[model samples]
Target chain A: QQPVQSPQAVILREGEDAVINCSSSKALYSVHWYRQKHGEAPVFLMILLKGGEQKGHEKISASFNEKKQQSSLYLTASQLSYSGTYFCGTEGRGGADGLTFGKGTHLIIQP
Target chain B: NAGVTQTPKFRILKIGQSMTLQCTQDMNHNYMYWYRQDPGMGLKLIYYSVGAGITDKGEVPNGYNVSRSTTEDFPLRLELAAPSQTSVYFCASSGGLAGRNEQYFGPGTRLTVT
Candidate 1:
């Protein structure tokens, strides 16, 4: 099943912080985060595996909570380049080849 | 290396027509996938292959067929295309190992069926 993302659209000013949450009905083995601009392929941000591991990239970080079956992406001091749609892909036990992506969260950062 | 490449970035097909969307990867990844994205909607997997000669259906595989005859190529065939099949298709590959499964996607093909 596909994951569910909260806050369908979010508009933020530069230097603001925003949190995007993704929840899955089935237990997730790993949660993948990607960002896509208009007319472009999604770019990988980071993958959060089981055991509640948190990974960070620059001012962005994500945490995977297997017990809660959810993940959250945190963006701090957002930049203009961060303006894009963010999607969270989830993989369950039997999923190895492809991922089930959520209906992305549209984030727009204004300068 | 060109991570993952898809051919015919865009195409328009008439009803009942057929076409194939080609996907290739140079990274020698063992896992390849095909997905479709409707306007303002999340991507839904159409088909996937773990390796050459092993293909399986995904969430939405009714109007689509796939073949994996080589490690670098996985093509998706749409037979008797319908207007419902109008969407952007993406081909992706991932390195499947102990725990790494980050997928690299192609530019995507915007297909319109009239």
Candidate 2:
């Protein structure tokens, strides 16, 4: 099943901070975060594995709570370049068939 | 390395028409996936392949088909196109480690069915 994302949209000023959350009903083995600019392909942001292993996108950070089957992306001191749609894809413990992505959270940053 | 590439960046199809969206990856990844994103919506998986000659359906697989004849190519086929099938399609590839590897995505193909 597809994961659920909170705060469908958010607007922030430069230097502001924002948090996007993703949760799943089933146990998740890993969570992947991606950012997509308008009319562009989705770019990999980070991946948080079940045992707290995280990788990719040094500028962006995220946390995964294995017990809760949830993950959160943190954007601190947001930059104008951060404006885009964010998606979180989840892999269930059953297997890594493919990621089930969330509807997406739109983040807009103004100068 | 031209991580992932897609052909026919934009296309328009008439109802009941057929077309194929081509996807290729130079990364030589073992896993490839196809996803469709409707306007103002997130991506829905259409099909995926673990390797050459292996494929499977995903969340929204109707009206679509796929083939993975080689490790580098995976193409999505739309048969009897309908208006509802119009969407931006993306092809992604990941390394051998399923959940541990980050997926690289292609630029995407925009299709409109009239």
Candidate 3:
């Protein structure tokens, strides 16, 4: 099943912070985060495995809570380049080769 | 290395027509996947392949088919095209390992069905 994302859209100014959350009903083995600019392919941001792990990429980071089957992406001191749609893909314990993705969270940053 | 590449960057198909979207990867990854993204929506998996000659259906697989004859190629086929099938198609490849499953995506094929 596809995961659910919170705050369908958000707007922030430069130097602001934002959080996007993703939750799945099934037990997940790993969570992957991606960012897509307008008219471009989605770019991998980071992946958080089970065991309540957290991963970071520059000013962006994410946390996965296996117990709750939830993951959150954090963008600190947002930059104009951070403006894009963010998606979280989850791999369940069911041994599926593909990850189920959330609808996506649109983040817009202004100068 | 051209991590992932897709052919036919843009196409327009008539109803009931058929077309194939080609995808290739130079990463030698064992896992490849096809996904469709509607405007303003997230990626939806259509099909996936574990390796050569191994394939499986994913969410929203109807109206589409796929083949993985070689480790480097996975092509998606759309038979009897419908307007609903018009979307941006993306091909991705992954290492297929526990912690190394980060997918590398192709530019994408934009298709429109009339």
Q: Rank the candidates by TM-score, best first.
A: 2, 1, 3
- TM-score (chain B only), all candidates: 0.96, 0.97, 0.96
Q: How many clashing pairs per prediction, in order?
A: 0, 0, 0
* True-structure RMSD, every candidate: 1.6, 1.2, 1.6
List, residue by residue over A1-111, the lDDT tens digit for candidate 2: 789999899999999999999999988888999999999999989999888789987888899999998999999999999999999998633444667889899999999
DockQ of each: 0.59, 0.69, 0.58
List the per-model TM-score of the A chain: 0.92, 0.95, 0.90
TM-score of 2: 0.97
lDDT of 1 at B104: 88
The digit string of per-residue lDDT tens for model 2 on B13-35 reads 99999999999999889999999
Give the lowest summed-lDDT range of ten residues in model 2 chain B: B94-103
lDDT of 3 by residue, B11-102 (tens): 99999999999999999999999999998788988998889999988888999999999999999999999999989999999887423467
| Per-residue lDDT value at A77 in model 1 | 90
Residue pairs with colliding backbones in model 3 are: none
| Whole-model Cα lDDT of every candidate shown, in order | 0.89, 0.91, 0.88
Consecutive 10-residue window with the lowest summed lDDT within model 3 chain B: B94-103
Q: Give me the runs in candidate 1 sitting further than 4 Å from their true place.
A: A53-59, B97-99
Query: How far in Å is the alpha carbon of B21 misplaced in model 2?
Result: 0.5
Candidate 1 vs candidate 2, DockQ winner? 2
